[model samples]
Each structure stands twice: as C-alpha cells, then as structure tokens.
Target: MYVAVKGGETAIARSWDLLAAARRGDESVPELTLAQIRQQMRLAVARVMQEGSLYDEELAALALKQAAGDSMEAIFLLRAFRTTLPRFASSLPLDTAAMRVRRRVSGTFKDVPGGQILGPTADYTQRLLDFSLAEPSVPAQPARAAAPLPDALPCVLEVLDREGLIEADLPPAGDPDPVDLTREPLMFPAGRPARLQNLARGDEGWLLGLAYSTQRGYAESHPFAGEIRMGEVSVFVCPEELGFEIDIGEITLTECQMINQFGGSKRAPPQFTRGYGLSFGEAERKAMAMALVDRSLRAEELGEAAHAPAQQAEFALCHSDNVEASGFVQHLKLPHYVDFQAELSLIRALRAQNPQEPTHD
Candidate 1:
C-alpha cells in the first residue's frame, strides 16, 4: 500500500522559471539570435538536423537555443517538432560524383582525380587553445588562383572496380522497396538500407566507441579511407501529379567511402569490400565512424564470424539511437515511489516472517 505523492504542479512551474533564468544567464550579455547560431554554430546546427532527420537550419538553430547549446537536447527538440510536419515527398538518391566538391581527401591514393582539396579543415592545426579567438582582430586574406572545377569527379572505389580489385556496388536483384525505419518498427536481421538508416542518425559518441573497438582488434580488418568528400548536393523530388523529378533544394553533405580487404568467400574471389557513410554536413569523424560500424555490421553478410559487439547488428542498431537511450536512462529520475514502496513492503513482510532465522545479527 503506497500513497500517491502530490503537490508538484506549482513546483514544476517554478522550476521552469528557474531554468529559463539560468538559460539566459548574465543579462548584460546580449542574447544569441537564431541567425547567429545558424551561421557561427553551423556544425552544431548541422548535427541537430542530421540526428533529428530534419533539414531546416532555422528550426535546428532554434532548438539549439531553446536547449541552451546541449546538442542532444537540441536534436530531441527538433525531432519532436518534425513529428508535426506532414511528409510531402521523398527525394531521389543523391549523386555524389556530381557534388560541387568543397573538400575532398583520400588515404589510399596519392593523386586522386580532382586533386585533393583540403578546404577548411582543422586537421593540420595545433591542438593548443588559441587565446586570440577571445579578442576580435582583422582577419588576414591569402592569395588564391581561380580555377574551374570538373563537373564530375571519379570515385576512388571506381578506380579499384575497373581493375577487378573490389566488389561491384550493385543493388540486389529484384530491387525491393527499402524499409523506412521511421514508418516501420526495426525488425531483426535488417538489410543494409535499414542498418544504414539507423546508423545515419545514431549517436556520434556511441558509434565512435564501437568503431574504436573494431580497430582495436574486436573485428580487425585492414581499412583504407578510399575517399571523403564534403560539398553541396542538389535534391530532387518527383511529385505524382507532376510525373517528373524537380530540383527541390541543395544541402551540404559529407560522404565517406571505406574500403576493407576481404578474403575470398565460397561464392567469390578475394576482393575489397566497401563501407559507406553520409552525413548532413562536414561531419568527417561521424561519417568515418559510421562507415566502420557499417562494415562491422556486414560481418554476417560477408560470412565472417560475429564475435564482437560491434559486429552484432541487433546490439549496434538497437542501441544506436541517443533519443531512445536518453529517454530510458532519464526516466529513472521520474517518480518511482509506488513501485519502490511495493518492493519495500514485500521485503519487510519477508523479514518479519524470517525474524527467528536472522537472530544471529
């Protein structure tokens, strides 16, 4: 017999007020506008959009502001808001070869077509904190040569494909409709499309840890960074009434192709297998981690032993969602008085019955 706890409404309202005050700390400092957050904190905005499965930068920025710069909270807010919007259309698959490449790099080849463009990366920068960023200063401009870029850049994997060194990237025969994880419950023994869909919006930190485990001999495979390209790609949607595809918009994307050496299987010869990852913006680390995890999940398909946690599709895909993980973990903070009280009563009754047996204490 547990009694219900009461008097939380007024306290909850007061807590909201306190939260608002804390979120807007130091009144003298100017408040951050959505535009400022959208532009300056573009990476954060991109991440929220990616994880939330919503492309609106404005909404993402608002979510970030409302959540006080907590990326996961911002993602949650954006995802909740996304549930209200009606789905009007589904876009055709993007063509990465035709992307207006801003940044491109490859680890396997020394001279890839389109020449390695190291656009706006912190990879070469010193890790030490730069105190100069605190003070405003005139930025220095560097001289540059104007050159027109190619319409389409050849993929590194395509080069391997020509020589019969890698497996052909072909859709399965009969080309079945892909499972939309949003509309359908994620069933076990998921195909590549469903697995990639889950991993696309999966928590970056969680995926990173799983990927790191693979490299540390959990599911060791010689992997090469075939190519990583970040740029803007056009999106197209074909409306039923229109009966033709139309260019809807363009969005920034980071695509990664990982090539892993695979031994000969019963059905095929020794060749290179591929892992792919695509993200909303210049999320190189996330994309790379996703690629590693993607490849790991394909262990069964490739006829390899699923000896590691990362290689286990069910474990990886089911736990990848941060929103689900956060909700389950945070729910513990909610009132559990009734449930605990029941357990308490049961324990007390058992102890009273066993009083003579515990007399040694």
Candidate 2:
C-alpha cells in the first residue's frame, strides 16, 4: 500500500526560502532600493497605487520592486499590505474643482482660460529601440520658478445654464461619502460609483489593451475622450459629530471625461451624455478607456442596444478587478491531483464499458 505523502512541511519551507532569495537577487549586487524603484519605475509605482486603491507613492514603489515590475502583482501586493494598515479617519469627498492641476487638456476646446500643459507623456515618442544610453549621466538642468496655479474654471455646464440652454441651474453637488469596495463583496448591480473610481487609479497597460480590443470591434468602439486632466484633488472628511468638513490630504489623479453622441430613441430626446473615469496617477489611457467602458456600460440607461459584451454591466464590473482576475488565472498552477484523478477514473470507466469504441477513429 502507498503511504500518504509526509515531510512536505520542510520542502515547503525550503521552497519559500528559495523564492525569497530569487526575489532578492544576488547578495554581491547592491539591493534594489525603494527610492530607485520610485524614481525610475514611477509608472509602475503609479499603477500599483492606482489599482491597489492606496495613494502612498513610496509603498507603491516598494511593491513594484517586490513584484518585479508586474503591475497587477504589485497592485495585489500593495492592496494586501493596505489591509493591515490602521483605520484612520475617512477623508471627505475630493473637490476636483479645487484640484491644483499639473496638466489639463480639453479635446472639445483648443484654447481654454488657463491654457494647456502637455506635461510628461509618451504620446508622440517613437517606438524605435534606443541603444545610446548604455551608461547614463545626469545633465545639469536649468532651474526655473514654479508656475502660478490656475483658478478653477467655472463648470462648463454653468456657462450653458447662464445662457438659458440648460434646464437645471444647480451647482454640481460634490461627491458625498464614497464607498470602499475592498471591505465588501461585490454585490449584484453594484452601485459603488466610488468603487469604480479606478479610471483614475488603474493600470495603464491593462486599460489600454481593453480599449484597443474595443477599437478592433471586439466591443463598442464609438468614443471620444472629451477631456483628460491630471492634478491634485483635495480630500475632506466631515464626521457626523463635527458637522463640518476637515481637510485630510491631497492625491494625484487622472480624470477622463468621455462623450458619446447618442441619437434620440422613441422614448427619449437625443442628449449629450457623460461617462467619467478617474485614477490615482498619470493614467490618461486607462482613464479614457474607463470612460468608454463606462458609457458602454450605460447602454441600459441610454436606451441603446445592450447585447454587446461591453454593454453587460455584470461581466464588465465583476471581471474588471485585476487582482481577482490575476489571482484566479494564476491559481491553476496549484496541485489538482484529486480533481484530475476523478476525471481520469470517469474516463477509464467510460472507455472500459465501450470496448468496441473506435479508438483510432
């Protein structure tokens, strides 16, 4: 009789040690510092912080290094670490109007009041391989005075309201208490608009691929990024007892507004609708994709065809979490002997019962 497997504990411990060593790399080489990861791999850190739903740049940088530049894995690592963090006072809703923007652009208008700041972007960078900088040297940069911050532009809607173009004249109500998704299981018809807040804080590569698939006619492709803004948004928390808002902190965010022109259906008049995307860092592509996906998800609301995969709220929202998707996909590597054995036994029994079954055919 075969004995049950034993002494697996020691093997498991050894395997863990090996994994740790591999992650750390050689002892002779200088250890990868968090600062190095933060400065050099800024995009990775930004992604981690965005998807991880935490705004700590330093921690995000460390997670990126630990995950070896795997944005999804780094997000998971950061999120897992975030769970252990102490619960501080929840901040109030951020006022995007008060956002001290580093960069802001509007596709709708070429020239706005404050003018445009292109900032750092790879939009025009050629994909050619650069072999010149084998050894990097810092060049002295010119010092310049800090640019003056622009005052918030009155909401574009306000302009329409003044001209009697809009039916409503009320100022935009600030986002009320936002809900946290990590603490709860995603329920059916999930309404956490705050939870879907990632268009601001999501992984750029992942979002870009999803957006590309749509453009390739895999999903709804008709979309235009109305505006993409990157800047700081202030967070405030007002306790019930305090009865007043208190400033918490500021976080860098990328916000995208997508416009989809919809024709009037039998039921409603044609109107310009909005889809919003927001994230924690310079994630314009992600935010734009998110806005498109968001509008696509509003097929029901817009009284449009809801047959497309992008139009399915359940599928899109449920599968959107990169951590959940990555975990389930990767978990297949774990031992599955018991399930495999069951399938094998069933197959053998079926085969034995049908001896004349055409094996070759």
Best-fitting candidate, scored by lDDT: 1
TM-score of 1: 0.93
Worst 10 residues of 1 by lDDT: 1-10
The backbone clash count of each candidate, in order, is 0, 8
The true-versus-predicted C-alpha distance at residue 262 of model 1, in Å, is 0.6
Q: List the residue pairs that clash in candidate 2.
A: 92-236, 92-237, 199-278, 200-278, 200-279, 200-280, 201-279, 201-280
How do the residues 1-361 of candidate 2 rate in per-residue lDDT, one tens digit apiece?
Answer: 1113345898979988887788888889788899988777777677788788888999998887777677777888888888899986777556776778777777765666666667677876897777765666677695542776665643433343365433342335884554566676656664537436533444455556656666677655566655677888878888889899887777888887766667767865665566678877777777787877776766776677777666676766666777777777776766778999999999999889977746573
Q: What is the C-alpha lDDT of each candidate?
A: 0.89, 0.69
- Candidate 1 residue lDDT tens string, 283-341: 99989999999999999899998999999998999998888888877777778889999
TM-score per candidate: 0.93, 0.84
State how far residue 326 of model 1 sits from its true place (Å): 0.4
